[model samples]
Target: MDSIFHEKQEGSLCAQHCLNNLLQGEYFTPVDLSSIAQQLDEEERIRMAEGGVGSEEYRTFLQQPSGNMDDSGFFSIQVISNALRVWGLELILFNKTKLSDGSGGFLH
Candidate 1:
């Protein structure tokens, strides 16, 4: 299948492809990263499947902080810690605030 590389967001490329297939207006199921990687060469595969860009493991890891937890602190302590770690690595953390405004402008 044809694929394109875009900026990172919440899901892996496999995840996004699974999502995008659904966004074409159908139901989606999880994808196997290995299957997706098989379609690309090593560098493209790595670009597509990196922990931050194509982070299957990281996506599963994200649910704990945002989903299940006890005592607000029990939840938040780990969440803040992870955020700090991502921020500490400037490259891995994307600035999600930038948006394109309809009035002929971009917000940065």
Candidate 2:
């Protein structure tokens, strides 16, 4: 059941809804989610082309990714966002690095 839910998440159907609802602006997009859900996705292409964030050994550990970026064997956005939406709250802290002007004014 968890796996199925995760699979749906990886497909990003939930993210689409979120975008339509809670997504304000800037970060997150349905296009971004869909790309990873399908094989030959742009993210995988970019990763391979750019020698992405992980080590070769880690890639090797994942059974070589089957050269298929679209397969959601474990993790995905649907699973992640669903979990987040169901039991999540946004947390942002006040920026402590405000600048102090010479006139005792602080800038955030």
Candidate 3:
């Protein structure tokens, strides 16, 4: 499928934009950012906060694999994976790492 591009807001709306792009079509209604943000729990919101990663709460959130739909500022791999799974799709992540040596090999 061709993706529709959307520039995200300053903060806390990347996932909403992603969802809008993913669901923009006749059969799917767009999701609202505020609605999604409202669904987040206190802990998730804290995790989403700027510089929250240094906090113990964010550390705890990272340790757990549950509650994928909590609007934690940015969407993690697990969140996207769970969202795709709900739509009967699988999420595949790809990365390329460049070699530090003089050789031009890339690791995938």
Candidate 4:
């Protein structure tokens, strides 16, 4: 590898920084990730609607905040996975892979 690229941590946007640093450039911003999160939220809502929008469960889901992201800038793994998919990259689950170094990070 060449010189390491590190995006200084700002606020609670670790996912955004991680993605940019991992890609070795400022390829993603908070807005970009948030947009992806919103899309995921909509997809989830649609899936829940498939179970009947009039159902209590669906109503409850609609009333709840998005699972993909929150106001504090936190993002779910699904968001990260989707962001990486844009670059043709994949994130392998830690438990599903053998970690030779025991380091915590996406294997792929």
Candidate 5:
């Protein structure tokens, strides 16, 4: 999908940006960081201090009962994959690691 990169606001809004990128051309309404934070659980809310959300916090939000993982304050590979799955979109993960021989290998 063609999407414009959104710069995060004062709070944790990485997830919002990711969602915008994923659904920019889709039929979903655009959402802001505050709105996303409002949906976060208590624990996830705490993680939204200053630096915004991290990978762990994003992951936790994805597993919430609401299943609105795209409304998290941050985004990670796992979070993005989960959000895409909710919309029937498939995501492929590629991991590149450097070997002892100074060569790169694709993991899995």
Candidate 6:
């Protein structure tokens, strides 16, 4: 790469900036991430409804704010993961992996 790609932090869009920086390009926008967040929200809603639309838990869940994202541009980890999925990539937690030798190989 000729130069490092740096996307300045804008508002509470740290997740969006982090994702673009990881991909080393301007490959995502707030709109893109928001769309992903919305889709996730819908999926969660459907799952909650599976327990019965009139159930108290489902109604309570509907009243709660979206866990996937917020109006202030903050997005949950799930949103970021889903965004990366579009490029056929997966997000693995560094501290969650172990090598055959029983060491934290993912950190390396």
lDDT tens digits, residue span 33-90, model 4: 9999999999999999999999999999999988899988899999999999999998
Model 5 agreement with the true structure over 39-59: per-residue lDDT tens digits: 444445465443455667666
Top of the candidates by TM-score: 6
Kindly report which residue stretches of model 1 are placed more than 4 angstroms away from their true locations once superposed: 1-28, 32-34, 41-108
Instruction: Output candidate 5 Cα RMSD.
Output: 10.9
After superposition, candidate 5 runs with Cα above 4 Å error: 1-10, 25-72, 98-108
Could you tally the backbone clashes for each prediction?
A: 0, 2, 0, 0, 0, 0
Q: 1 or 4: which has the higher TM-score?
A: 4
Instruction: Give candidate 5's TM-score.
Output: 0.36
Q: Write the per-residue lDDT of candidate 3 for residues 1-108, one digit (tens) a residue.
A: 486655445466466566546756322222433333234445465655555667887677667654534435555555555455556877655446545763455332
Q: lDDT score, residue 25, model 4? A: 93
Query: Between prediction 4 and prediction 6, which has the larger TM-score?
Result: 6
Q: Score every model by TM-score.
A: 0.17, 0.25, 0.39, 0.85, 0.36, 0.86
lDDT of 5: 0.50
Best by lDDT: 4
State each model's CA lDDT, in order: 0.35, 0.43, 0.52, 0.91, 0.50, 0.90
Which tens-of-lDDT digit does each residue in 5-104 have in candidate 1?
A: 3433443333434343433422222232232322333344345446584477655553333331232212222232332333352213234565345433
Better of 4 and 5 by TM-score: 4
Could you tell me how far off, in angstroms, the CA of residue 76 lies in candidate 6 after the best superposition? 0.6
Give one digit per residue, the lDDT tens place, for model 6 in 1-108: 799999999899999999999999999998999899999999999999999999999999999999988999999998998999989998875665577766676633
Better of 3 and 4 by lDDT: 4
Question: Quick one: RMSD of model 1?
Answer: 16.0
Judged by lDDT relative to the true structure, which candidate is superior, 1 or 4? Answer: 4
